[model samples]
Target: MVDSESVKSSYPKSITTSAQDDRGSMEKKQSVQQRVDSFESGEVETVIDKNIEKSALKKMDLVISPIIGFLYLMAFLDRSNIGNASVAGMSDSLKLYNERFNVAISIFYVLYILVETPSVILVKYVRPSRMLAFISLAWSIVVLSSGFVSSYGGLIITRLILGLLEGCLFPALSLYLTTVYSREEQCQRLSYLFCASGLAGAFGGLFAYALEQVHVGNMAGWQWIYIVEGLISFIGVPLSLFLLPDNIEKSWFLNPQERQVARLRNEANLRYLGQQKFDWQEVRKSFKDPKIYVSAVSQFCADMVLYGFSSFLPTIVKDLGFTGLQSNYMTIPVYVSGVLAFLVVAYASDRTKIRSPFLISASLVSAVGYVILIASNSNAAKFTACFIVAIGCYIGPGMNLGWLNNNVAGHYKRATAIGIQQTIANSSGIIAGQIYQSKSAPRYILGHSFTLGCVLVGLIGYIVLLFSLRYANNKRDERCARGMFDPTLTGDYADDFRYFL
Candidate 1:
């Protein structure tokens, strides 16, 4: 996968100094050694690549993308299956009429929010492979147990634990992928993975349709949904533990020379981020950084639509005069559209090395979809709007994840930032779960209006962020022109580190 010859010819080779610069060369060697030591010790910042081969990257995509995507797919199905279950008699069986179903949905986010940041920070101590396997296994157990929940309290408890176990997964996955790919490369990679949520949506509908027809011993169709999905997740545990590589250095697929080049390229990113050593100061630095908050806020808005729509699409479709099974079948196209749009936008963004334009454009598309739903009574218009919203909401999160990954550097700072963003952003899940109440059924004007406002807020936030980043980069350039920029500066704070627009 690592095409050493092609990469060598495409980029300028590093010059080795002769006997004339023996003293300087010695110092340089020591510095490089220190960097390598730091990397091995888990004290160094992330290494970024200047460029990697298309074929080499494609090889990696084949290995990592599908695995990560499948993981997310399972997570989505487990998390959202309750929605489908509710319509299939879980509500009457569990007596979750009125707002009780909403409460059950909202309660998952309480523990989910609490554990997100800390779990991601914990990944720094534990290897990503081990952490991911453990989380997936634990959560699968919880989800399987949920199938047997006969009481409201039992369901609540299981949902809370499910949230806690799943809290670490997304942020951990994002951080793990960043270790291997450059910023520009991350968009498509993230899309490939995130597109799983869309796939999950489509597959979930099919699973719901298929499972609803089953008559298992002592279990209802709703219970079968949970049991089968949980079992599917359990199958992935062994694969992650045995087959997944933790980082490039340890990958079984790469040769020594490729590893050396990858290390060097990543070292440049380490230099940009400043220090590889763990520092409390780095975590505190993220607290003071405005970019992190902006990204988090933008994520918050985007996820409102994502969580709300994914969880409630079946209910909404059922309101359009379809039977329970028919509603599940109808949801396939919305998710399919979303997956297509996400892949296209991610590819374009990566090729152009830009995010804001696509993000803003997609958000506007979602906003218009919301407007259509709100303004129209026609069934065709509403269904078309569903597809538009699905397409639009799915694009922002992947781009924003890449945005933070590219701009934020340092181990603790980046980890903490990701955790914080996920925590704050996912809090929208609570709000989304509660927004589309049964009382507002059929039209759901209030729910549609609320999401419309959310996307607009996200659009405005990205626009401001784009200009502010440009201004910051300009100021850094001005300092460099005056010879006042720090030679030691690296990563995004460095005068030379350009933000991915």
Candidate 2:
């Protein structure tokens, strides 16, 4: 076993300790340095017992995953419940005629797209716990205020504010998960987060159906939908502030030994640590990286379907001859299908360590669903097509995110790429709102055909990305074999780094 002094001495004098060292004691520094040296020497498993690492990871799964998942559930609920409200009569109450309601829906994405990149960049500067918690609280207030809106103009303003606040969430949480979990562990954890959208859809439909029966004062059922869901999100604020740790080193739930193991796991996974200062070069690198653009195209196409489908599901169901309450209940099964499908796909992706195949498969599955929806006149067939469409809805976006997060390295670079990817992808929400306008309802041939085309486009993008990443990896391997690689290169640029294909 390596002793503490020798372990501390092994690190070069030029290698600076983390910023946390200033606040931590000498003993803490020694412990951390010892683990770092062990990782560098490829003896980390010997230094930190495997059981301890497993315990630490299991603990993170228990604490972090559920809290973030619940927050995302609320976020998705508030965002998509507008669809339920429209069906529940917010449109008539607020005099939303013709394309007015579509404008209200599209307006949210304008701010959402503008703020995603900046909000993710801020996650490095801000404590994630504080940032996420504060954003959740702020959006909850916006959601609550939405319940009281007396006019379309009032609703628009509330949606704008909600967009700005909620924009920070997905990217921030994605980045935060990267900080805590290894690359191999990421997809399953992210599925939990992404699956929350499906759960929110399920719960929102159930809630909307139940709330529609309420006769509280003069408040409509649509108003109660927003009020009740908004109030539930307030629970996340305290949960985040108290239970969520800023990073592995600062984790309140782990013991001293488990913290060391967690740090070692992060190092083994090639995750950048303690280097939170923003770098302009990394930001520039993200823009120049061809993979970001490819991933953006894929994400954009997937989100177009995601936003269009989720936002208008109730309307789609209602057009099938169901009453408002029946439409709300019918949406529950569709969302549950998405949640289950995503969980299975995510597990298989993680186990196989292959993302592109699953992503390609998802696009194909959803495309077939859209084809059925567009051609079928039978309501039963159309409803079955809804289930088929949902199977790949969460899988494509969830795996796309995990793929990007897996490939990118360095904190700021990854943050920038995620922001860029999400920004471009989320703009699809604008198109989603317009294409599914009231004029296109009943059959919604325009919307279904458009979404079908998106799925195919996204499929082609993923295939291109797969070949490009494979080519890049081969080039890197050739350079390493010839000893032409730079020893000083780190992060994803390192000669030893191989993209997960």
Candidate 3:
């Protein structure tokens, strides 16, 4: 016993728990507390919860991304199926003489533009899930009714209604994503959802191919397209209503602990952004910001290419000497390629935390694609160029949306800004639909050239916006150094906030 006691007195135990570890933990808590104190002081109302676990992030993505993606897939299919219908003899059946087909396409955007802002603003008034479900049902009914349209005038009326409903989807989705995710997480999540457009294109091609083979009852192939797509959308309405959460705190799928984690994450974010309640002042502030208009113009330029290609790719391929079936088949490869490029660009943008470079690169790729389209006579070369155009046009706009969202803050202000952006950008649909006239078959040289010029203009705008963001950031840094910054500023107005260029 005396020997054992002597040995123990001579030995020292290893230190697994140290005072330093406790100090570190306490310091972290203190840091969070300090930030909370600042938030309470009303300097900014947003908070950041560094303690949010990886599992929580995974759960959020799982819950939100796929649902939005699926919804968008259906919406895009319903909207752009008219393109498939065009080559399926819709024009001849409806006696759509001259550019009346184009006029029908153009008319959709008129109502889309008019309703874009109100639809997005409505998301704030009602729950997002309910609003989305109601709109989806409404649009699906309109789409189903489109099959019954016997005349060009009827088609025009259906399209007008379709556009008005569809206008709610994109900008509302954009704003909804902002509510559940942090700024850095948005682009990738958006891309995850945005890949649906390409999927819709691919799926639409197959659907079109199958419908063209059917001749059931009085319905033609184009009518079948609308009927089938509408039915599919109708099936999704209930699912969306059930699955889409109003916000993180209200998510039915998440357990209480996960809900608490989500609430913490969102609360911290709200505090950091300095936003708690809706303010009409923020809405007024957005209109005065030059960045809003610049982003809108930039979107307009990119969409000129997007709507141009999306609205007419099937017809373009058909005009290149392929059968209608073959044209539909050809679209598969283009859209698949575009989806791959879109995912790659989105991932890279999120990883690098840069937006404009990808957008500019995409624009350049599309510009080159358009040049080849205009210059080439070989069908094979033109087909390859179509792939390039698909990649560029689809990918650029994906990032552009994230870029615009990144630059704005506050719930209502962000919604208003996105609404305005969509309103202006969708006008390109009208422009795109009209430009690719039937008279310009085989090689739509004017249409290709116009799209090319638009992409170039967008490229220049991206460059200018890049420099402008950098300039603003530099000025902010200077003001911070001089102690001239407003202490009570929050969100985009906060000195700590910088635009992602």
Question: All predictions: root-mean-square deviation over Cα?
Answer: 5.6, 6.7, 9.1
Q: On residues 1-501, what C-alpha lDDT tens digit does candidate 1 reach at each position?
A: 422332121011122334455587686766545533432332323332324434346566777787787888899889988887886778888999778899999988998888888888777578878898998899999989888999988999999999888887888888777777766678888887778888878877778768877896888998888888889999668867877788765566666644665666465455333454667887787888898999999999999989878755776687688885677688888888898998999989888878899999999899988998899988888888888888888898878878887777666788888888999999999998877887787778888899889899989889988999879766755654443546565445655456667
Clashing pairs in 3: 45-271, 45-274, 46-270, 46-271, 46-272, 46-273, 46-274, 47-268, 47-271, 47-272
lDDT of each: 0.78, 0.82, 0.78
Clashes of 2: 0
How many clashes show up in model 3? Answer: 10
lDDT of 2 by residue, 208-252 (tens): 778777779999989998998889999999998889999886699
lDDT by residue (1-501, candidate 3, tens digit) is 211111010001111233455577766656545543433332333232333445567877887788788889999999888877876888898988877878887898998998888778778688888888898899999999998888888999999999989888889899888888767678888887668888887777778778877899978988899988898898667867888888778678777766776776565555223364678787787788888788788889888887888755766677677875676787888888988898888888877778988998898888889989899888888888989898887777778888888778678778888888889888888888888887887688888888888888888888988999889777766654443546576657666556777
Worst 10 residues of 3 by lDDT: 4-13
TM-score against native, each model:
0.89, 0.89, 0.87
Clashing pairs in 1: 43-276, 43-277, 44-276, 45-276, 47-266, 272-490, 272-491
Q: How far does residue 217 in candidate 1 sit from its true spot (Å)?
A: 2.1
* Number of clashes recorded per candidate: 7, 0, 10
Q: How well does candidate 2 match the true structure, expressed as C-alpha RMSD?
A: 6.7
The parts of candidate 3 lying over 4 Å away from their true place are 1-52, 271-276, 319-321, 488-490
> After superposing candidate 2, which stretches have Cα over 4 Å from the reference?
1-47, 270-274, 487-490
| lDDT for position 143 in model 1 | 89
Instruction: After the best TM-score superposition of candidate 1, give how far the Cα of residue 131 lies from its true spot, in angstroms.
Output: 0.3
